[model samples]
Target chain A: EAGVTQFPSHSVIEKGQTVTLRCDPISGHDNLYWYRRVMGKEIKFLLHFVKESKQDESGMPNNRFLAERTGGTYSTLKVQPAELEDSGVYFCASSREYDLGLSIGAGNTIYFGEGSWLTVV
Target chain B: DQQVKQNSPSLSVQEGRISILNCDYTNSMFDYFLWYKKYPAEGPTFLISISSIKDKNEDGRFTVFLNKSAKHLSLHIVPSQPGDSAVYFCAAGDYTDKLIFGTGTRLQVFP
Candidate 1:
């Protein structure tokens, strides 16, 4: 089975610009999630999608960020007016609806991305 | 609130020795625990998991022990190998539908 796939693998945008990261979860999987790690901080949850419907978005950092899971197949996270603080690895994960074990995608690993490596100059 | 905690930032151990990594949680509602391993530039890979109903779960050379009373859990790797060097993260869930992750502890198995 094809694992989750992310787009642009890496992105570099200037401060004040906008960037959207995409994730295509495993087929037939109903759960999708977004997480990020800023600098030395732990990876933090941003939001979750259970088939197009956002189950919980309490972890979203602020108003500058927005996420959508249209049709429940693919998910997107948009960071606006990007700041230096947003310079970190963004990860996407997905799992089966009833199964708690996340069948992660290869690109969604939380390690490092070559990283969007944004220079908010 | 940081529900899960990994006190050690990094650990160094000799190959063939045992490496014990610890995790503590403050959430009493969490009934499921998991460990994930990550190599540099890679996403985390699921190691093993144990539900609250079981005190322990073992897979190959890795063992996960959960002590519900203390809200503490540990991952023990016996006969540690150099390939086992990576960052380890402990996570918790409650059928709350989402997993909460710890900061992670880096494990370095010295040759």
Candidate 2:
């Protein structure tokens, strides 16, 4: 089975421009997550999706960012009016719904895709 | 406020030695902790994890130890190999599924 997959592995955009990054999670996986790592910063969660519904988006940096998961299949994160500070690697991850504090052993682990490196110049 | 922190930005170890990476978290509510390994041009991959209830968990050459009292966790790789070199991230979260990640520590395993 294919792990989570992301497109446009690398993107370059000017400030104030818009860029959309897409992620295709593993087949039958209901959980999808978006994360970003700024320069010299840790990877921060942006949002999460359970199927097509937005579960939690508290980590979204600002109003300029939007994430959507349509039909509970794939997801897209869009950043508009991108700024220099927005340049970083955007990662997408997926997993089955596992119980909290339970074993992350076989059949209950999260997988990540090759992140999309975005550069805002 | 950064909930999780990996103080060391990098670590180097020779093959056949032990590589230990430490992480500290400030949030006592975080009930789950995870470690991720990222290779160049790849997203961070699931490594090992331990629950707040457990003090230690091991898999193959990797072992994760959690100290609830100190809110600290460490990942140890025994007999480190060149393939073990990568950026390791520590993440903590609760049932909410919102994970707070620490700045990664790059591990260089020399042959």
Which candidate number has the best TM-score? 2
Per-residue CA lDDT of candidate 2, range A1-121, in tens? Answer: 9999999899999999999999999999899999988885788898989999998999999999999998999999999989999999999999888444564543376678999999999
Model 1 alpha-carbon drift over 4 Å, by segment:
A98-119
State residue B8's C-alpha deviation in candidate 1, in Å.
0.9
- B34-106: candidate 2 lDDT, tens digit per residue: 8999898789898988878889999999999999998899999998999999999999888777888999899
Indicate which candidate wins on lDDT: 2
lDDT of each: 0.79, 0.90
Model 1 TM: 0.90
**For residues B23-71, what per-residue lDDT tens digits would candidate 1 score against the true structure?**
9999988867878898776666778888777788888999999899999
- For candidate 1 chain A, which ten residues in a row score worst on lDDT? A103-112
DockQ of each candidate, alpha-carbon based: 0.31, 0.71
Q: Considering every candidate listed, which one attains the maximal DockQ?
A: 2
Error of 2 at B105 (Å): 1.3
